[model samples]
Target: MDRKHVLITGGVGGIGVELVRLFAQAAYRVSFTYRPGEESRQRAQALLDEVGEEGMHALELDVGDRQSHARLMDTLSLPLDIVIHNAGVGTKTVERAAATYKEQDEVFFRVNTLGPLWLSEDVIPGMLARGHGKILLMSSVDGGITHFPRFRAADGMSKAAVAFLGRQLAATYACTGIDVFTVCPGATDTPMFQASTLDALSAEQRRLLEASLPGGRLIAPREIADLCFYLCRDEARILRGAVIDASLGLGVCPAVMG
Candidate 1:
């Protein structure tokens, strides 16, 4: 097919859904991954129907599974022109002494950090042969730029590694027709965000938290989607290794991050 093919991980999630919609609207042949479940399948189908595009496919993926990465590559029908590593586990507050902390940490690393690394490895050979490709890693403001108190340490560590991964890939692929970019969004208004951060808060507490933000609101999924779409364009090659802070000032003002 003449249209560029893009693969997005976590396509049923808030930001992921927007990414799929935006890319499909722009005429890209999108193949997005969703976790396997009846509910997830329904959501993916809903998104596909909403997009009303012919070539968009939603495939099952377990981002934390290395074998799943290999299986996904084998399942693709076309060489990917764009890869967006967006699947991730949100922050889970756990005391260091907890028995399950180690296991949880491993899950965070496998999904948030190593998933991109493995998938990139799987796809890069084809991209190199084609002489052009774009990759965007969806990191978080907590990655390295800022730290939120009481948040899970493993989440931050994994995301920081993702930022480093993007930089490393960009450096390695520089001038080789492959571009990699990392984006760190802060307090995005997503289902994950609400469940992880806001659901526990009282009504007043929620209001206070929003009020503390730069614009009295969380970042929207569409905003991040738009920026990501632009970063994947040929013109954005100049910013190949840029670690963007899409935090809307939360990274700059850390006092309110908690």
Candidate 2:
């Protein structure tokens, strides 16, 4: 069989870098996107050099900008077998939602929700023509529900929409050889995770947070990456339309795992 091609958004970030590495190692022709900047370009190039995979490529993308997404779609030279909508942004103005919620919500929807929807529209036609494709949506445990403080409402709402989009797409294209999967990860050990408000937690609070999880630890990005890679294989067909909880036991709380 020919090596498959994958396109991943936000490939320079913690979880995303791991995803790219795993896909490249699996012999997939991988192309990823990062924001516009010399730093982003250099980091992407360095990653490609480190992976030593000729099939790896990178491009500048701002998911929040529709024109940028359009340009990317027009410039793509190959049919994609898999598209991972992994780019996201959560509102950082946590304690000041009253003043910032409106602006933050718009950005959250543009990047975390509407951007993926628009990109999927561009790619699904090609997938339909080929009769085979996969879409992986990166949601969050917060989207479904968890025992956390009521903050980052914009992020949670946008991700919930993403989860819904995945399910709807799966149902719409069921027999068309297109599959959709949504991965709602919990507190994975990613830079984003570490950079969150958790950093402000006291030592005792931090210990409590870690102990709260069944495993007494945060989920690793590589574990999520491995799950993603496995789902793309032929043997995992039954997982179509599945909303997988990669939350390291966080989903066990059914009452909270909405």
Candidate 3:
């Protein structure tokens, strides 16, 4: 039997790293994409070195660039068993891109929504031919309008679209060997979470945010990673088209009313 292969986008990031580690340790040939630049290369190499060079590889990719996605898929030799679309910019970053809401929406939608859509479409044909594959999309609890405290219009719309895309793909591929699903995580503790998502909050704001969730704590990156790994297994086939919420009960409340 051939060695299973998995490709993950934004693999150098917090949750991405955990996902890469779990898959690589499971003996799968893992290939993950990082954005182009020296820092990204260094991050990717450092992680790959820890896993050893044999079955791990990293590529520079801008998931936001459709051309890059197409080029990478076209050049790949291995048939993938799993593909995790985990790359995304936080709402704060999107908000900071420009003063206008239209500008922010444009940037967020392109990266957060279109990136996954295009990349998945590019890879789906190969997966179909191979007759077995798993694709997991990383969305967020921000996708739910009523649950989150602050309304981030672009972020919510983009993530919601991703969730919709996953469901559509799963329905389209029903009964096939291929599987599609989305994982909606709440506030995960990661560098991105710290910098973009939480840095601006005051102590009181942070307290309220934590209290908003059932656990009253941030979700660990590894927790989501473990969930991603589990959902890709054969036993998880019945979960096709599902938007699995690993949100630490954040959505249990109807709204974050003060």
lDDT top scorer: 1
Error of 3 at 54 (Å): 1.0
The positional error of residue 242 in candidate 2, measured at the CA in angstroms, is 1.0
For model 2, residues 1-258, the per-residue Cα lDDT tens digits are: 877999999898878999999998888999999877898889898888989859888988988789999889888757999999988875452222235567777888888899899999999999999989999999888775343545476778888898899898999999898989999888787766766746778889878878877668888888888988888888888999998888877867533322
lDDT of 3 by residue, 180-234 (tens): 9899887789876787657988999988877876788889999999999999889
TM value for model 2:
0.91
In candidate 2, list every pair of residues with a backbone clash. none
Ordered from best to worst lDDT, the candidate numbers read 1, 3, 2
TM-score of each: 0.95, 0.91, 0.91
The alpha-carbon RMSD values of the candidates against the true structure, listed in the order shown, are: 2.5, 2.9, 2.2
The true-versus-predicted C-alpha distance at residue 126 of model 2, in Å, is 0.8
Question: Model 1 clash pairs?
Answer: none
**Native-vs-model 2 lDDT?**
0.82
